[model samples]
Target: MYTSDPTPTSTLLDAAQTAARLPYPLLVSELALVLADPAVQVPPRLVQPLPGGARLLIMPALDANTAITKLITFTPANAARGLATIHGDVVVFDVATGQRKLILDGPTVTARRTAAVSLLAAQRLAPNTRGPLLIVGAGVQGKAHLDAFAEGLSIKEVVIASRSAASAHALVTHAQSLGLQARVVTNADEALAGCPLVVTCTPASGVVLSTLPRSDAFIAAVGAFTPQMVELGPELCRYVADNGTLVVDTVDAEHEAGDLLQAGLDVTRLASLADVIRADAFVVNGPVLFKSCGWAGWDLAAARTALAVLPH
Candidate 1:
């Protein structure tokens, strides 16, 4: 029997540092490769509802030699207590021996990998776009996306929109601290007006945008995973269906993304991120929508990347 010592643990800060060391393009390419492999297994995520509207999520992925599982919890009410809504850990193991290798901070890996994948789609679908990037939501994903874009893409300015003015302003301050020009917008419509790239990371149960986005924009909606919650409305879906293809991280999106479910989108017509990367072309010459509901394969990829950079 194969045996191993106890696994090393990495914190959120360590995960962030490790993720930062890797280039966005490389991360995107790695994800594309993983998704394209026929041998890689990404089963549907398991969900268990807890009391008080909280839920636990179990996501697992496996390749030939590596396996990983992420255990996360979503507590919407945590925000009232000034805590993060999502929290958990990712466990990585050796597939051949079933030996645990490493444990990583789940939220950090999720944020970084999610943002990186979004940027990947944006790069391919809207390569010529120059910002003024618009980011909706002032939470963890919001800040992480800001940092990713700042480091990976060229942008002249940034606009942040949130339900609360204080949250938006605080994110603006955070952006300035990073030496990026950013400001707060009063509403989503104002923020989406002329921005070439838009990212939504809120947790609103209903449609968050009050107005239609520009026809030439590339929108990345990362919030609203469950079928009952949505960030984008039917109008946006219709627009994309009419002009450009609606892109998703995986085929599982049809079952997990509330934005797509609420819009009654045709899953048969939606394009996967792997297909986009492989084709290296946009499905249309108009606005594109990329909706991601978190994938376990991403957690696996991120864990491998983080472990490579961490000291032994």
Candidate 2:
């Protein structure tokens, strides 16, 4: 019997390219399939802190022959030092033989996959939008979303709102350097009213944005994975449930999201990514909201995709 060649390792740039070229609809399709497939199991938070406030998150996903295992570690100090806040590596292992095939840096993959998930949500939830997209956080995830959106959507203007005005302005300059129209906003409401699509990428105990544009607006809250953390208000959860369709990354994690549970948002009522994709069309009888805690299935989808593309 001949053993297969070793799995090939790739870089974050490889992941970013995969994210950029992969059609948005197809990513959502993969998400739907991954959600329905019983072989997939996403474990709860596996975070461990090392020296110097550095942290590690073990994210594992098993989808039949494809098993994507990731070890993510980072430090805010590292980020301040012009390094990565989230860095480490991902290993694609063949479950049949438990053979580690490929390894890639976690920071790039993390940022790319996170942005891909956001784009999937945006395509499905946000309507035919134009101009002034508001990004709540200016960190890695926030910047990744801005970069991905600039490539995928027709966003003419971008307004980044962060707790630090300087950081927000730096992101604006960075985005402009990338040749996209951008600015910084210190006021949340002003940014929301100016932009129809609002993406919250920060971690806050309370809502960062309230009183969104009452029109056909879309909000995608990508931060706040823990029960103690949330970026949107309890009212926003009600807004999505009452006015628009609420899409969750996983129904299982909904109970953990404080924004949803505190507001008494019915998890059963919310649709899954599969539900959204398999459906023929989206009927927005009301406002739409997507609360994503970043499911492991997404990492699986991206990791699997990466493994398939990388040479072994």
Candidate 3:
């Protein structure tokens, strides 16, 4: 029923403005519904390797009325050049007429949805104890997660850990500007100890941290989407698998998450994010692990919310 001669394009700033208008809880709830709805269709993502070890990923999802596709490129070598490692765009379409609806900045969509999803998991998995928050990697995802959690949760103290001390200090300064008590730590173990909530947002191919989190801590790893990259080590995975809940955004995560794949976790035992959202008796007994490899349905849901709030 909708058609346009030229599709409207939304910049990353526009997407951020729209995100600011939509409450975090609403965004998470919408994504949960899309994940639980039997009518929604999300096919497996397609991957293609490019020259110089870069890779292109295509993810498509459709509900009864709308459809969206996200095209992403991962170039690890770009980091050395002071560029973003991942970049892409999302295309939204009207299913009824097969007409283009909106095109959104992919990195912005990814950062917001990823953090929102992690917050949803943290709300469900994090213990009731009040402790310092630890964020590893001071990149876009790191900053996004900090903002998302700060908006919804009662975080009193924040600790930032990054390979670069300057980056960590800068993030701490940013957090302080937002009225958050924050500090920087060079040691991963020192940062992980006694933290009630932890989120890792790095693209490290090997284990980023070897320290074990507190028994009641909830950790969210948002990096290492491919089979060759990992942020959490095998010991951490085994600890959660043995003593706590291990949840992922989608069942397909077993194939995409390098941490889980390398950890040799039993895919059949992992629970989906939708399951956690829908379950009424869910409880975490110890440290909890929530791994997200990104999903097209989340991008579609975010774009839809943005479109509804954007001014005409």
Candidate of highest TM-score: 3
Residue-level lDDT tens digits of model 1 in 185-300? 87778678779789999876667774676778888999978888789878887777787657888888878888888888786568888788678554556777888888898876
The residue-level lDDT of candidate 3 at 312 comes to 44
Q: What are the Cα lDDT values of the candidates? A: 0.78, 0.70, 0.80
Q: How many residue pairs clash in each candidate?
A: 0, 4, 0
Name the regions of candidate 1 deviating beyond 4 angstroms: 1-25, 280-282
Worst 10 contiguous positions by lDDT, candidate 2: 1-10
Tell me, by lDDT, which candidate is best: 3
The full ranking of all candidates by lDDT, starting with the best, is 3, 1, 2
Q: What is the Å distance of residue 300 in model 2 from its true position?
A: 1.1
Assess the local accuracy of residue 209 in candidate 3 as a C-alpha lDDT between 0 and 100. 72
> In model 3, where do residues sit more than 4 Å from their true spots?
1-23
- Candidate 3 structure quality by residue, lDDT tens digits, 1-312: 112224445344455554563457777777777767776788888989999888899999987767889998988778777898779888877776787776777777788889989988888778843557899999878888888888778987889999878778989998998888999988767778768789899876668876777778888998878888899988888888898889988887878888888889876578988888788878668788999888888887776666555444
Off by over 4 Å in 2: 1-39, 43-56, 73-85, 310-312
Positional deviation of 234 in candidate 1, in angstroms? Answer: 1.4
